[model samples]
Each structure stands twice: as C-alpha cells, then as structure tokens.
Target chain A: MARMKFLCDAERCIECNSCVTACKNEHEVPWGVNRRRVVTLNDGVPGEKSISVACMHCTDAPCAAVCPVDCFYTTDDGIVLHDKDLCIGCGYCFYACPFGAPQYPQQSAFGVRGKMDKCTFCAGGPLADNSNKEYEKYGRNRIAEGKLPLCAEMCSTKALLAGDGDMIADIYRQRVLKRGGRPQTWGWESAYGASG
Target chain B: MKTLVSTMAGLTLLFLGGCYESPNVTTYEPGVYKGPKDPLMMGKADQRAETLKKRFELVQMDR
Candidate 1:
C-alpha cells in the first residue's frame, strides 16, 4: 500500500494561503481554528520562502505517544487520525505535537479548550467513509473519491503536493534535477543576482 | 508474542470451560488496518502517463 503523504515544494510555493482556505471551507472548521497555516521563514523579506503547515502525521506520532486517553491511531496509509469520542480534551497532544497541529475549539464559557481537532488529511474520522457524521466533525473525504487532499488540490502553484510518498519525492526530485542543482531554488534570483 | 499467546490460551480455556458465553475479542492481522474506510483508498496507479496528466491539470489551476 502507498504511504500517503504531503510535500510542499518550497521552490514552487507562492504563499498563496489557498491551502489554508481550502481546508477551512471544505471542513467547515469552527471559528478560531485553523487546520492548516502558512509560515514564511523571513517575514516581509524579498526572497522569503513559505510552506503550508499542518499535522505532518509522523510515522510514530508524538501526539499518539503522549495522549493519555489513547485517542490517536494511524491509518494504513500513514494518515494519523483521532477519535473525538475517545479524546478527553487534555491538551497533551497539543504539547507533544512538534508542528502545533492539534487545536481545541473555544466552546466553553471559561476558556475551556474543547475536543482536540487537527488536520485529518481530508480523510475524515473513524466513522464510515463519506458519512455525514464524519463530515460534520471532520471534512470531506476526498480520498474516498480517489482524490488527494483538498489543500493540495486547491494549491494554485501545485507547490503543495499530496499523494503516495515515493511519487511526490520523485516529482520534487525531478524538479530539482530539472533546475540543474539546488542553488537555483525558488527566489534565488530575487535574493541574489540572476547570474548562474 | 508471549502476551498474545497467553491471552489466546486464556480465551480458549474460558470458551472450553463454558464460563464465557461469547467473547467480543477482535483479533487483527499484523500490518493492516481493518477500520471503517474514512477517506477510502483509490486503486493503485498503472503508469506515469496518468500521473503526468493529473499533474498538468493541477498545474494549470488558475485559482
């Protein structure tokens, strides 16, 4: 089975924030919660590189490791998912996650963080595939329809690539090879002179 | 493996002793997930031509 993955090619990324918007709109994610975000390395700089960030769904997820309730589970495709029913809203996953992917909706009166929510890789939850219940909590199941993550699909520059790991690695590698080397990366000309 | 073997043995003994009417245990094979298909898988790809076409369509995205 293909190890499902996402790779944002910094070279092609334009920091459009389309991926973020796509995620929110598709999932109807609650207010004050962003499943995906754009992080630019050098703010306001001419040659800044930005990559859309979210739950990387690591091989051995730290969130799973730290979750006291054991809500987290990884799919065969390596997409990490959590059961809201099993979650205790403890925020341990939040602290354990390296990318700050876990989010809690501000629903309670006294600033109580609600159930942990994060990027589901557009795969929804443990419920039946493409079910309305799954859609209510998670987002659309584009994967069920044989499509990639909506974030990657909505990417204007095709910079945010999502699919099997090996396939995307090859794509990114070919792009690099096509450019002849890594020095001619994105914004290289804007950062330095256009002499190669 | 030892724990699993012991658990299975205990379950078998319980069944044989008639103390356990119906066990709700679910034994799963290793290296496979048998949960509800949330975001189900598409069948595998056959060749690069399809990939190239898909990439082209995405790259042509004007939005």
Candidate 2:
C-alpha cells in the first residue's frame, strides 16, 4: 500500500502553471474554485522560487480537526478528503488550514456559503468511486483508477513528485545529495513537521 | 362552464410544472467525458524506473 505524498522541488519549479492547469482540467473544477495553484515567493529578485500549492493532506490535518460537522476523513492511503454532502459550508476549515486549501464556490446574499472544496489527492469523496456525484462534487478519482494525481504526472519538469512517501523521499534525497546542498523542502516542515 | 374550464387549465399547468426536468441531475456512466490521454505520461512503470535510475546514477557519480 503506497502512502501517497507530494513533494515540490522549488529548485526545479519554473513557475509554470501546468500543474495547476492539469488539476483543473482533470477535475473540470468550477470557474471560481482552484483545486491547485502555484505560489511564487520574491518577485524580480535573484533566485526566486515557486511551488504548486493545494491541500498538503497533512498527517494531522487541521481542516479535519476544525470541521464542526465532522465532514472530513482521511483515506487508507493518507489522502485527506471531506464529504461535501455532510459539509455545512462552515469556513472553520479554511481558517484552520495553514495552506489555505479549503475554498467555497458560492457566497450568496445573507451569509450563505456553499460546500467547501479542497484538493482530494485524486482519491475523491465518500460518493461511489468514479461516480457522477463524486466527479461533480469532488473531482477525478485517479487514485482509485491506479493512477497518481494528474498535477504531478503532468508536471513538465518533474519538479513535483507524487507517489509512495518513501519512494519519492529517496528520489528527492538523492537529488539533493547530488547537488551537494541542504534539502530545502519549503512546506515539508510546516505540513508534515520538521522531524517527519 | 367557465369555472369547469378554468379548473381544468389550472390542473394542466400543475402537471406540466411537475414534469419539468432539472439540468443539474447528471450521471457519470453516460455523461462522464474524458479528454485525450497524456502523451507525455511515460506511464507508471517508466516513471518509477526513471526516478530510480536517476537516483542510482547520482550515487555512481558520487562514488
């Protein structure tokens, strides 16, 4: 059983929105909702870095912790997912999440908020795997189809590695070793913890 | 006769409204649309092999 994980190498990322576009295209995400995006730090400076951003699917996910309706759950493979039907459109998860992953599609008059949407790790929601309900509410179920997340797969430079945590870690570790430098994984410590 | 015809017309409008279909009810089996396969997909096996080979080549270069 692979413990799915995502590692974005800032050294290699060229600020291309290919990963962001791949995710949106694969899921047919709504116009207002972005399941994934690229965030660049430092503008017009020497050695600027950008990394694709989405739900980190944290080991101890704060989004799950803050959901008052108990809509969130982690899959066996460690993918963090939430039940849109059960979700009450509360923005608690959004405030709690460090990555600002959870997004609401509609904010109508009179304090109305639609269901919260976030990265599904391509595993999908509680709805039947690859079902229409799942696709409409969540996105693609590539994980159930024996495929990794499209964002990483569609990466042009292979900067984003997605697969078994152990496997990709080894790959990343080797690259860092060859380059002869400290492993500067930007969000790893914040998402997975410093020791993790 | 006027009351009878008016009642009948009202009932017919009610029936038509009930029969109206909603567009939001979409099904996956017939409705799911897939785009073209990614040609750059080196496939899963190839992706794994490529990563592993790169790791080993790095180690060899280090040695």
Candidate 3:
C-alpha cells in the first residue's frame, strides 16, 4: 500500500470551514487547538483562493528531526504522530514544521506548557487501535476503522481528498483533465516533497 | 552581626551557584523514529489497503 496523503483542490474549495469543523468535532479537540483550518490567500478580494490546511505529514518531517525528546514517528502509511508523554512542550516542532501544524493548548507564564498537538491523519497514536486512551490523546482511529480522515470525507465541495497518495493523485489529475486546465493542488509538493 | 551577615552572603552565593542553566544542545540522529510503534502497522497491510480502497470507491470516488 502506498503512503496515505491529503490533497486540497483549490479550484473547488469554497472556504466553508466545514472540514475544520468536522475535524474538531470528530477529535473533540481542545479549545485553541485546531487540527484543520481553511486558509484564504486573499480575503474578500477578487479571484481569491482558499484551501484547507493541516499537518501534511511530510516525507522527511522536520518536526521529528527537531524534537528534543525524540517523540515524533511516522507510520507505515506515512502518517506522522508523536508521543504526548514524551513531548516537552518546548515548541521546537512548531518552528520546524513548515505547515505550522504543531499547536499548544495554553499560553501561560508559569512554565506550564501543554503537550504539543497536531493532526494525526485520523490514525490516532501508538496506543491500541480505537482504544479510549488513544482517542483521548490523539483522536479517533478512523484509519484502523477502514475509513479516511473526516476532514476530506466531509468536505462539502469534495475539494479535500485523502487516502492513498497515488489514488488521490489520479483523482486530482482526472479533475484537472476534465476541467481542461491544470488547477493547482495546494501544498502537494511542500508536504510530500517534489516527487509526488 | 558579622557572623549573621556572612551566613546570609554564603546562602545567597549557594543559591546563585545552583542557578546555572543547563545547555540545551541535542545531538539529533537523522531518520531515527524514537516513539512507540503504531498498532496499525501490526495488522495485515494488504487487508487494510483493500478495505480503504473499497471505502474510497464507496464514498470518495469522483464525487
């Protein structure tokens, strides 16, 4: 099986923020931490484009490289996840991540930094599949349940595609061909590198 | 009075001595994943992929 990936067709996205809402609701993500969000390049401007953004789960993930505690790991399906127990909340991953995927739950001066949180591709953490502990820490294990990420599944415009990288690439290629133009897929090269 | 002042000075010096910051340098080994093994990887890869493919066809294909 090829690596799992996400593709956001910018031409089709309508900036509805439904993907963001679905992810937050699915994961019961804590306040101030968003697993997914819609980014608009030019708000209220003519010909503005919006795309849903989250952890792209990069091929050579910078987050894993810079982690002081060595908490981050990539799965066989290319999903990047981290051990919250080992995370020191030092925010190195935040700086290292090009997508700005890492998030902290709080902002306090008492030196009490919360654990780092990011999108898990709905695969949950290292814990047992669909277990309570895994869900509590890393959200639902939709991948284990034979389902794709909710953000892509629930996209109102079908703009967000998530699954096998090659499969989604084919889908996007077909869309572009049918439309008779090459529409930009946001963040594809950045997240997966130039090869994909 | 002399002895009391000396004691306070010594205590302050001790506290200062203990306040030195530890170095934050880390030797990063590239491509090494130090986190726990994901349970998903333990399952059959072909079966999981087939299931996901069916799901994609059911819900995510060319909609």
Candidate 4:
C-alpha cells in the first residue's frame, strides 16, 4: 500500500489560495472550520512565500496517539481518519497537532471544545466508503474513487502536489531545480525534528 | 503476594510504553512586530481579506 502525502512547493505557490477554497467547497466545511489554510511567511518581504497548510497525515500521528477515545486511525495509504461517534470532544488532539490542524466547533459555546475536525486527505472519515453520511460529515472520498485531492488538482500553478510520497516529492524537486531555489529544511525539522 | 508484584510490573510497563518524547518544533508565541519596511512590498494589507473573500465565494459555489 502506498503512503499518501501532500507537498506544497512554496517557491511555486502564487498564494492564489485555490487549494484552500477547493478543500472548503469539497467538504462543505463550516464557517469557523478551515480544513486548509495558506500561511504567508516573510510577508511583504523579498522572499515572501505562502504555503498551504493542512493535516500532513504523519507516520506516527500525534493526534492519533493523543486521542483518549482512540477515534483516530491511520489507513494503508497513510491517511489519518477518525470516527465522529467515538470522539469525546476532548481537545488533546488539537494541542498535540503540530500544524494546528484539529478544530473544535463547540469551542464558542460554554467554553467546551467540540469533536475535533481536520483534513481527511480526501479519503473521508471512518464511515463506510462513499456513504452519504461520510460525505456530509467529512467530505468526498476521492481516494476510493481513484482520484486525488481536489485542492491539488484545482491549483492553478500546480504548487500543491498530492499523491504517493515519492511522486509528490519528485514533483517538488523538479520545481525547485527549475526555480533555482534550495529546499528549506524547516518542514521536516518543524514537523518531526532530527530524531524523528 | 506474587500476583500483586506481577500486576505492579505490568502497570509500570504500560505507563512507560505510553510515554512520548516531545519534538523541538517552535510553539506559537505571540509578540509585538517590530520590523523594517520593505520597499518591494507590492500589495495592500487588505489584499488578504479580499483574496479570502473570493476563495470563500468559490467554496460556496462548489457546495
């Protein structure tokens, strides 16, 4: 089984935010829930770059490890999914996530954080494949449908690449070589560190 | 007494196995911005808001 991943080339990203929009639309994500976001680094500077951020679906996902109810689970393709039914509305996953991905809708009322929601990597949730319930709660299960994420496909500049880890990395490497920009070590260092 | 010792040993292993090491990633620390101006800055600060609005509109249509 291939380990799925998403790689956003900061050098190639035009900050158009097509990825963010695609994610929200595909999922019908609520007003306060952002499945994807663009973070502009060195804004208004020479090296101004915007990277689309979402759940990275890590090898040893902290969210999955920290979930008290064990709602989160990793698929063969490395997509992290969770059962909304099993979620206890605990905010541990939110705190454990490095990318600030997990979001709780009930945070506004009574100071109680709701069940955590994050990117499903277009694979939907723990619900049965292609079910309406899964679509309503998570989003489209494009992976099961033999398709990639809509965000990467909708990217006008082709900045966000999603597929097998090696394929996406190769795409990013080619872009970096063509653009004459060195790859930044920040992503892995920030995500898992040297020991990881 | 033998059963009690084994139970204690099992509990210790369970607790030790669950321990996770923290990564060295920088936490989000809020602070005041004090930076020099950039001459090459091309757009207005409000551009982000405008872009976000357009993105939201696109998302609304997809749903």
Local distance difference test scores for all models: 0.77, 0.75, 0.88, 0.72
Q: After superposing candidate 4, which stretches have Cα over 4 Å from the reference?
A: A184-196, B1-63
Model 1 Cα lDDT, one tens digit per residue, A1-196: 5566778888788888989988999999989999999988777988777888999989888888887766777866788988887777999989999999999999879989888999998778888778899899887876655566888877778889877777777787888788777744346685676884
Residue A64 in candidate 2 has what lDDT? 77
DockQ list for all candidates: 0.11, 0.02, 0.44, 0.02
Candidate 3 to truth, TM: 0.82
Q: Sort candidate 1 into its docking category.
A: incorrect
For residues A1-196, what per-residue lDDT tens digits would candidate 2 score against the true structure?
4466788888888998998889989999888888888998775688788988899888888887767767776655567777777778979999999988999887688758899998887877776778897789888887656567888876778888776677778877898888998745455784688799
- Which has the better lDDT: candidate 2, or candidate 3? 3
Off by over 4 Å in 1: A183-196, B1-63
Candidate 3 regions with alpha-carbon error over 4 angstroms: A107-112, A184-196, B1-31
Best of the two (1, 3) by DockQ? 3
Better of 1 and 2 by DockQ: 1
Clashing pairs in 1: none
For model 3, the docking class works out as: acceptable
TM-score of each: 0.73, 0.71, 0.82, 0.69
Top-scoring candidate (TM-score): 3
lDDT of 3 by residue, A1-196 (tens): 5788988988989999999999999999999898888899878998888988999999888998888788988877788889898888999999998888899988587756699999999999989999999999999999999999999988878999998899999998898889997654446774587787
Candidate 2 local Cα displacement, residue B14, angstroms: 40
True A-B contacts kept by model 4: 0.00
Q: Which candidate gets the maximum lDDT versus the true structure?
A: 3
What lDDT score goes with residue A5 in model 2? Answer: 77
